[model samples]
Target: MEQSQIQNHNLEKKRRRVLNKPLRLRCSVQNYNWGILGNKSHVARLFSLNSGSHIDPDESYAELWIGTHESGPSFVDDQFDCLNSLKEWISKNPDVLGDQVLKKWGGELPFLFKVLSIKKALSIQAHPDKELARALHKSQPSLYKDDNHKPELALALTEFEALCGFISLKNWLGGADAEQWLPVNEMDKNHELEAVLESIFSQILLSSKDKICQSLSKLKWRLNLEKKKRQLTDKEKLVLRLEGQYPADAGVIAAFLLNYVKLNRGEALCIGANEPHAYIYGECIECMATSDNVVRAGLTSKHRDIQTLLSMLKRRQGFPEILQGLSLNQYTTRYLPPFEEFEVDRCILPEAASVVFPSVPGPSLLLFISGNGTIGASVPEEQMVEEGDILFLPAYMEFTITSESKELHLYRAGVNSSFFQAY
Candidate 1:
C-alpha cells in the first residue's frame, strides 16, 4: 500500500476499535424533594452501588438518569480512560450515534432514560408538541430549556399508579357506555364530548382561589359522608392522599379530570405529546425525548403555566391504552410506541445461561434491574454488571451477556428501528 493510504487505513482501524467497545457509565442521581427517602430509594441505592459510597438515610433520591442530557449527564467510568461527560464523549465521536441518528439529532442522544422513585404526586402537567416546543423555548428559554418535544413512556418496575389523559365523561358521569355526556345536537358525538371536556377542564384551571377552597371543602365533606356509608374507591382515596401533600391543591381536583390507571410490573404507559399525566407513586423506567420542558398547572409551589398548558393540551377523553411487550427472541421482549425517538427492550437470562443481542441500528443505554452478569462484545473481554449498573452500547455492535444469578433482568433503550429501515 502507498504511504498515505497505509496511514489512513491504520487510523480507520483504530477508530473501529474505540467505537464498538461497550463503555460503563457512571450515571447521575437527582435529589428532587418528592423522591424516595434515604436508603429506601432505588436511585440512592443505585448511586451507592455505582460509587461504592454509603447511602444517606435522610436524603431524597428521585431519579437515576442514564443519558447525555444536560440536567443529569453521565460520565465514562474511571476504570477506563477518563472522559469529561457523556455529552462531550458523544460530541467527539459523533459516529457513535450512528449516521442517521447523528444527522437527525446533530451528535446528541435523542432519548433520555431514567429510573424514577415517586413518593408523592408529581406535577399535573403536559408536554407540548415539536412546533409548540420550539415556540415555547424561543419565548421563555428559562423555563422551557430545550426546543424538542417530549413524548415519554414509563414501564412499571413495581406497582405503579398514574393519572393519564382525560377520563371518558360519557361512561364516568352518565353511566352510559355507548351514550354521550351531553345530548347529541348537530355536531359529531366525539367532537361534542371533546368540547365538553375542554370546557370543564378550562373552568377547573380558571377557578378562583376562594371558589377552589369552597369546592374542595364541599367535596371533602361529601367524601366523608360517602365513606361513612361505604369504603372509598381508589380514585377517591387518591384525592385524599394528595390533599395531605398539597392541601386543597388544584391537582387534587385533577383526579376527577384525568383517568386513574394502575400498572403492574412489566406493563407500560405511553404519554404522547399534549397528553396530561402525572406519576402518582412507585418505581418505574422512564424514557423520553431529551428535554426538560414541563407546563405545570398545579401540585407544585413553582410557577404555574395554566394558559400555556391549556393551549397545548388535547381535549379528547377515553381510557388510554396500556402497552404489553412483544417477544423479540427467546430472552428479550420489546416495547415500541408510535414514536420515532426511542424504543425499549427487556432482556431476561436464566441462571448460567447466555444470549447475544443482534446488532442494532443505533447506540443504546442499558440498565441492569436485577442480577449479576458479564457483558461485552465478546466473552474474554467482558465486564461484570450487577443490579443498578449502566452500560453504553455502540451502534452496530453485537452484545453478549451471561447471567450469574437466579434470573437476570435488564432494559435496553435505543432509537426506533424504523429510523434505520428508512435509511
Candidate 2:
C-alpha cells in the first residue's frame, strides 16, 4: 500500500481506541456540621469519597463532575489525573482523537454534574450572562468568572425546597394587603413599589440604595415583630425573617417561599442564569454547564454583591410554572432549557425496567443515588452500582443498568443540543 493509505489506516485505528476509552467521571459530596454556615462537607466527602465521622444521615453521597474544566476535573483512571491534562495526549495523537471533538470542543469536555445535600437554604443568588461573565473575567482575571452561562437543573433526592425564578409581580404584590399591617403596607398606592411590585417586573428596575433600604426596613420590622410575638407558623417565621433581612431579594417574594414543596423522591427543578433563585432545603442531584461564577444578592451570609447581582438579574416578573413543563419519557424526565450546552434528566427505573443506554453521543455521567443496580459499560458485563456509586460513559458508548433490589433512581448528565450542532 502507498504511504498515504497506510497513514490513513493507522489514523482510523487510533481514532477507534481513543473513542472507546471510558472516562471515569469524578464525584464530589459536601457535608455540613451543625450550625456551621457555608459548610460544604457533603460536597467534599462525595468528591473525595471520604466516610469520616462527620457524615450525616441527611448528607449527600456524591456530586458527579464530567467536564474538562479545571475547577474539579474528572479522573480518567484510579491514578486521579485531571481530564484537562489529556489535551497533551490529544495533541500528540490527533489521529486517535477525533477531529470533530478537538476542533469544536477544543479538546475539553463540556458539562459538569453535581449532587448537593443541603440542611439549610442556599444563598439567594444569580449567575451572569455570557457577555457579562466574559467582561467580568476580562477585568478581573483572577476571579472565578469563565464567560460560560450556567443553566442548572436539580432533581430531588429527598423532599426538596427551592426558590426558583420570580413569582408573578401581581401574585407577590397582590399578596401584600394594605390592611395586612406589613411594612410594605406603608407605601402609597402610587409608589413605585406598589405599582412595579404587582405588574411584570420589566416596567421598572431597582436602581437606588434608598429604594432597597426602604423595602428592607419594612421586612425587618415585620420579621422582628413576628419573632418577638411568635405569632407566625414555623415556616412563615423563617421566610418572614429572611425577607426582612433581604427585602430586595426577589426569591423572598415567590409564593413558593411561603410554602414548602415536598418533592417525594423523583421530582426536579430547573433554574436558568439571572433568574433569581435559592435552594431552601433537602438533598438534590444537580447538573449544569461547567461554570461557577455566582453573584449573590442575599438569603445567606456568603459573599454579597447587591449591585452586580441586581445588574445581572433578569427582572421580568412571573413565577416559572415548571412542574409540568419538562419532557417526560417512561423512565426519564428531561429538563430542556433555551441554551443547548447542557441537559439534565431524572431516570427512575423499576426493578423490571430495561436498563437502556443514553442516545447522546457526547460524554455522559450517571450518578446512582439510590437502589442496588447493575451497570454495564466499560466493565466486563454488568457491575453492581449502589446508592453512592457514580458511572461515566464516554462518547458513542452504550450501557445498560438493571435494578436488582428496589426502584433505581439515577441522574444522567450530557452535552446539550448546541454542543452537537456546533461540532
Candidate 3:
C-alpha cells in the first residue's frame, strides 16, 4: 500500500476493532427523591431486583441513566471500575463518537437517556435554554454545572400523568375569585399573564401555612359538595390526587392552573426550554440534552428556586402539543423533535423478521425496553439482549436486529441528522 492508502488501511482496522461489535452497557440507577417507593418500580423490575438484591424496601427508584452524563454514566462491558468513566473512555476513542459530534461537542455526550419512575409529583420546573443556560452556569456554577440547554422528550412506558405548561386560566378564573384563590398583589392585578403567574406563585410561597391550609380545606369542601351535585372532571380528580399527596402545596394549587396530560404507552410529550412541567406519576423513557439543571417552583421537599423558575418560565397559556411518532416502515418509527441535539426512534423487531440500521453522524444508545432478541453488525458478531438491557453502538456502524422471542421492542437515542433535516 502507498503512504495514504496504508494510513487508510490502519484507520479501517481501528474502526473495525472498535465498531464491529455492540458493547453491552451497565447503567447506574438513581435513587432520588420523588421516585416510586419500594422495588415495585418498573425500573427495579427491569433491572431484575429481587428479594436478594441489596435494596431498601422503602427506597424510591427514581431514574436509570444510560448515557455519559457524569451524574450516572453507564459503564462499558466488563469494565466494572469504569461505572462513571464511560465519558472519559470515549474521549480516548474519538472515532467511536464520530467527527461531527467531536467537532460540535468535544468529547462529551450530547444527550442523556433515562428511565424515570415517578411516584409522587416532581417539582413544578423548567429548564433554561442554551443562551440562558450559559449565563446561569456562568453566574451560578454550584447549581447549574453545564453550559448547555435541556429540552426533554419522554415516551410513556405506562399510563403516564403530568402537568405541562399553562392552560388559559380564563375559565377557571371567571368561576372563582382569582384574588381569593391566588392572592395576587395590587400591582399584578392588570399585569400580563407572565407577571400575573409570578404574582400568584409569589403569593403561594409567601402565604402563612395556616392560611394555605384554610384555603385548601375550603377548596376540598367545595369539591366534595360539587361532587354530590355532579361527577367530577378529570382535572378535579387530579387536584384531589395532588392534594392527597402534598396537601396545601403551592404546586398543587399551581397544578390547577396548568395543562393536565395523560400519555398512554408509546405516546410522547416534548418539553422545550422554559416550558414548565411536573411529572406526576408512572414510568417513562426520557431523553434530554446533557444537563440536569432544573429551576423548581413547588411540590417537593427539595430546594425551591421560585425566583429562578419564574424568570426562566415561558409564561404562556395552553397545553403543549404532544408528539406522535411517524412510522418509517412496519418495524421502525421515528420521534422527530425540533431540537438538533437528539432524536429518538422505536423499533419492534418481529419474530423471524429483521431490520437494518444504517450509519449515523454520532454514536447511539440502544435500550431494550422489552422482549428478547439478537443484534449483530456487519462483521457477523452477535449478542442477545433482553428487557432492560442497553447497548452502545459506535458511529457509522451498521447493525441488524432480529427477534428470537415473540417480539423485541427497543428505543434508540442519538444525535439528529436526516429526521431533523425534514423537520
Candidate 4:
C-alpha cells in the first residue's frame, strides 16, 4: 500500500478495535460537603458495589462521574491498560467519538454524565454562555477550566427539589409572600418587572454580612412561630430548610426570590446556560456539557464571581418546563432536552424481559441503577450486567439487555441524534 493508504488502513484498524466490544467501566466519585453521608448516599452505594472498594461511612458521597471529563474521568475495568482513563482512551481513538462530536468538540467528549446524591443545597450559581465562557476562560484560566458552556439537565431519581429561575413579579411582591418579600416591594416601588427584580437582587448581593445574618435569624424566628409554620408555602418551607443547612447565608433568604421546583421521580428540568439556579435537596441524575466552570454568588464557601454571575443571569420569571419524557418503546422513555449536547433515556425491564437499543452515531454510557441483566452485543457474545454497573459503548454499536430476576432500571446517556443527521 502507498503511504496515505497505509495510514488509512491503520486508522480503520484502530476504530474497529475500539468499536467491536462493550467496555465495563469504573467511574470516579466526588465527595462534596453537600452530598449525603456514608451508605445513605446512592453515589456511595453504587460506587462501592461497582468497584468493590471500601465505603467510608463517615465520608460524604456526592457525585458519580461517568465520562471522559478531566474533573472525574472513568476507567475501563476489563482492558489491559486499566491505568489509563477513558479520557486517554479517547485520545488514542478519536474516531470513537463519532463524526459529529469529533468535528465539533475535537477529541474530547461533548457531555458529562453524573449521579448526584444531594443532602443539602448546592451553591446558588449560574453557568456562562459560549461567549462569556470563552472570555472568562481567557481572563481567569485557573477559575474557569474550559471555554465550553455547561448547560445541564437534572432528572429526579427520587423526589427532588430545587431553586430554579426567578418567581413571578406578582408572587414576589404580593399575596402570601408580601410580608416576607417586603424589602423587594420597598426597593422597587416604581420599576417594571425586570427592573424590580434587578433592584431586589442587587440589594441582596450588596448586603452586609451582619445584615444578612440578622435577616436570617428574623426569618427563622417568624417561620418557627405557630401561626406562620402552618401557612408556610413551598418556597417558605424551602427557605427554612436551606437556612437549617446553610445558616446565615444569603441563599437561605434567596428562597423568596427563586422559584421552588418540586420534581417527582423520572421527571426532568433543563437549566440552560446563563440561568441562575441551585439544586436544593434530593437525589438526581445530572447530565451536562463536559466543562466544570461555575460562577457562584452564594449558598457556599466556594469562590464567588458576583459581578459575572449578576451580569450573565437571565431575568426571566416563571417556573421551568418540566419534562416527563417521551416514550420510545414499551421499556424506554427518552428525556431529550432542547440542548444539542445531551439526550438521556430511562429504561425499565420487567423480569424475563428484553429491550433492544439501536445503533447510535455517537458514544454512550449506560448506568445500571438497579437489578441484574445480560447484555448481548453483535455476534454471539453475552456479558453479565448487574446493579451499580456502568458500561461504555462506542459509536455505531447496538446491544440488547435482558432482565433476570426483577425489574432492571438503567439510564442511557448519549448525544442528540440531530448532530449526526447532517453527516
Candidate 5:
C-alpha cells in the first residue's frame, strides 16, 4: 500500500473508533487529607455545577480529578464507565491512542490533572524522584503507595501563595537574625546540602517543646516590633502566619527554611521531585505524573515522616522559576512546564469567537472554568459545557469550541514531545 492510502485507511479507522468528537466524562471528587473546609471553596461550587447539584455545606472541597489513575479514575456515564475501558477500546484501535503516545507510554494517559481549592496551608512535603519512588513503594507500600515520580505544575486560578523549594543560600544564612540559627552559620560552606539540611532540620525537629514555645513568642514580639518600624519580609510574614495557624509547632520554623512564593492569577510554578512545598491559599490547577506518594514534614495533624522527608530533600537550593504562558495564538496561551508528563493551555474566547483545534497526536482532558461553550467536531455533533464541566478528547479527534457567553474560559491538559525537550 502507498503512504497516502495507508494514511487514508488509518483516518477511516480513527473516525470509526472515536468519531472525531469529545466525550463528556464524569470526573470524581476527592476530599483527600488536607483541603479547605466547608462549601466556601471554588472547588465545591465547581463540583456542584458539574454534578448539577449543591455540595454539602459541611464537607470540605479539595480536588476534582479527570484521569484514569486508579486513585480517582473518571467515568463516562451513570454506568460508571472507566478510563481503563476507554484504554481497552484504544488498544484495539491504536489510531485513537496515536502512534507517538502509544509507542512511548504504551497507550497510557501519563498524567493526572487536578483543580485544587485551598483555604488553609497544606503540610510541608516533598515527592520522591522516579528511582526513590519505586524503592519506597516496594519497601513501604502502605505509606509510599505508588511507584511513579510526581513532578507537578501549579498554575494559579485566583491569587495564590505557596512555600516552594529553598531560599537562596545568601538569604538563608545572611538574614538579619542569622545568629539565631547558630550551627547553620557555623557549618562549613563546603559541606554537602544533604548534610547541611539534615543537621539543621534535625535540630529544629528535636527542639524541646518549651524551646519551640519560647522561639514562637520571641518571633511574635520581634514581628510586632518590626511592624512599628518597617515592612516585614516575605519570609517574616510567612513565619508569622504559620505560627498563628500552628502555634508552637516546629513547622513554624520549617517555614523559614523554604522560599515563600505568591502567585497572581495566571502565574505558575513547576515543582520538581524532592522539592519541599506547601500550598498556602487560594485556587490553582495542578498537573503531575500519575503518583500520590508524598513524604510530609509538618504544619498539620497528619503523620510526619521527618527522617524520610529529610532524606529526600534535593540538597541543591535555589529559587524556583515562576512561569508565564506563551501565547499560542489570539485565543490560547500554552503554559508549558519543563516536564513531559503534562502541559496546560488556557483558552480565552471572546463572546462570539470560535476556535478550531486540529487533531492532536495524544489524548487531552479539558475543564470548563467559566462561561458557557459548545464543543463539537462538527456543528451537528456537540455538547453544551458550563463551569466545572470536563471533556476527554481522544487522540486523532479534531474539535472546535465556540463561546456562547460574553467570555468562555477553559484549560486543556495533555502530554507531548515538548515534555522531553525541556527540564
Candidate 6:
C-alpha cells in the first residue's frame, strides 16, 4: 500500500475507535439478608463490592455501579483492572470526556450511579453541603470530604416511601398538638430553638455533652404519650408508637413524616443532601453520587455523627417536596431532577412500541423492569431483553425497543443538557 493511503487508513481507524468507545459500566450485586437492593444490610453489602469482601450468599444481592467516581472502580477487563480511583481517572482522561462534560464539571464524573433494593428505612439523617463537607474533612481528616455530599434519587421497583427534605415551617406552626413538640419540630417555628439547636451542634463538635440530656428530656415528654384516637390512620399509629420508643426521633414530629406517599411501580423521588430522609419500606431502583458518606441522626444503629449531621440539617420544615416534576411522553414518563448526576425515565410499552432516542454524546444505562422486549442497536440483529435485565448503551448510538408481551416497563438513565442547566 502507498504511504499516503496507509496514513489515511490509520487515521480512519482511530476516528472510529474514538467514536465507538464509551465509558458505560455495570456493577455485580453483593448479598444481604433482605437480599433486595434496599435493605440496610444491602448498604453494607454494596460497600463490600469496593471493600473486596466475599459475596455472602446467605445475605447478599448485586447492583451495577456506573459513573466516574473513584471509590469503587468498575471491572474493565476479565482481570478486574481498576480505573484511576474515580477522581484520578477523570483527571487523566480529559480528551476522552471532551469539553462538554469538562466545562460543566471540571472533567470529574458529576454523578454516582447504583441500583438499590430497600427492605427497611435507611437512616433518618441529612448530608453536608460541599463547603461544609470540605471544612469537616479538613478539620478531621477521618470524617468528611468534598465528595461525601450525597444527593440521591430512587425509582420504585415496588411501592416505596421515604421522608425527604423538610416540611414547610408553616405546616408545623399551624398546629399546637403534642406531636408538634417532638424534637424534629421543636425548631419548627421558633428561630430561637433553631439557634439553640445549632449552638448545641457546634458545642457537640467540641465533645461537650452538656445539653444532650436537656434536649432528650424535652423530646421524651412528647414521645411518651398514649396513642391518640382522634381519627389517625394505622400508619400514623405506628409512627406515634415509634416516637414513643425513640422520643428523640425528630422524624415523628414532622407531620410530613406522617405523609406516606405510595409510589407505583414506576414512580420516583429525589432527595438532596442535608435533606432529612428515611426510606420506610419496599424495593427501589436507586441512583446517587457514588459515596457512602451518610451522617445519621436516628432510626438506625449505624454510626451517628450527631454534631456534624445537625450542623448539616436544614432547619426549614414542611412535607418533603418531590423534585423535577414528572414528565410523560407517549410511552415514557421521566423524573428529571435539578442535578446533573442522574436522570431516570420509565417507558411503558403496550403490545409494541418504538422509540428513536436523540443523538447525544454520553453513555446511558437501561433496565427492563417488567414484561419482555427486543432491543435493536446499530447492529441488524436484535437482542432479547426481559424484566430485571439491564443494558448499557454507548454515546451516539440509536436503539429501539419492541414489546413482545402485553406490557413492557423499562427505565433509562442518561445525560442531557436539562440536567446540567438545572444545577
Which candidate comes out best when scored by lDDT?
A: 4
Q: Report the number of the highest-TM-score candidate.
A: 4
In what order do the candidates fall by lDDT, top score first? 4, 1, 3, 5, 2, 6
TM-score (all chains, Cα) for each model: 0.91, 0.72, 0.88, 0.93, 0.87, 0.70
Query: Root-mean-square deviation of each candidate, in angstroms?
Result: 4.4, 6.3, 4.4, 3.3, 5.5, 6.2
State the lDDT of candidate 2 residue by residue for 116-222, as single tens digits. 66655667677777788888778866664587767777777667776666544455445532224322333344566434443322211233446545655565576
The clash tally of candidate 6 reads 24
In candidate 2, where is summed lDDT lowest over 10 consecutive residues?
198-207
For model 5 the TM-score comes to: 0.87
lDDT per residue (tens digit) for residues 131-211 in model 1: 999999999999989899999999998999999998886756654211121222343334665576666666766778777
Tens-digit per-residue lDDT, 253-326, candidate 5: 87777778889999999998998899998899999888888888788888888888887787667778899889
lDDT of 6 by residue, 138-236 (tens): 776555534456677888767677666544334434543333443343443355644543433333333323443454455444345433425554444
Off by over 4 Å in 2: 1-21, 29-66, 79-103, 176-195, 198-235, 240-264, 323-329, 378-380, 417-423
Q: What overall lDDT, based on C-alpha atoms, would model 4 receive against the true structure? A: 0.86
Model 5 regions lying over 4 Å from their true place? 1-19, 32-34, 37-39, 78-95, 177-198, 206-210, 378-380, 419-423
Q: What is the lDDT of residue 75 in candidate 2?
A: 44
Provide the lDDT at 305 for model 2.
67
What overall lDDT, based on C-alpha atoms, would model 2 receive against the true structure?
0.57
Give the whole-model CA lDDT for all candidates, comma-separated. Answer: 0.84, 0.57, 0.79, 0.86, 0.78, 0.57
Separately for all candidates shown, the number of backbone clashes (residues 3 or more apart, or on different chains) is: 0, 15, 0, 0, 1, 24
- What's the true lDDT of residue 332 in model 3? 91
Between prediction 4 and prediction 6, the one with superior lDDT is 4
**Which candidate model has the greater lDDT, 1 or 4?**
4
Off by over 4 Å in 3: 1-16, 49-56, 79-84, 169-189, 192-199, 418-423
Error of 1 at 38 (Å): 1.5
Runs with alpha carbons beyond 4 Å of true place in candidate 6: 1-25, 30-64, 68-72, 76-98, 139-148, 173-235, 240-262, 323-328, 379-381, 419-423
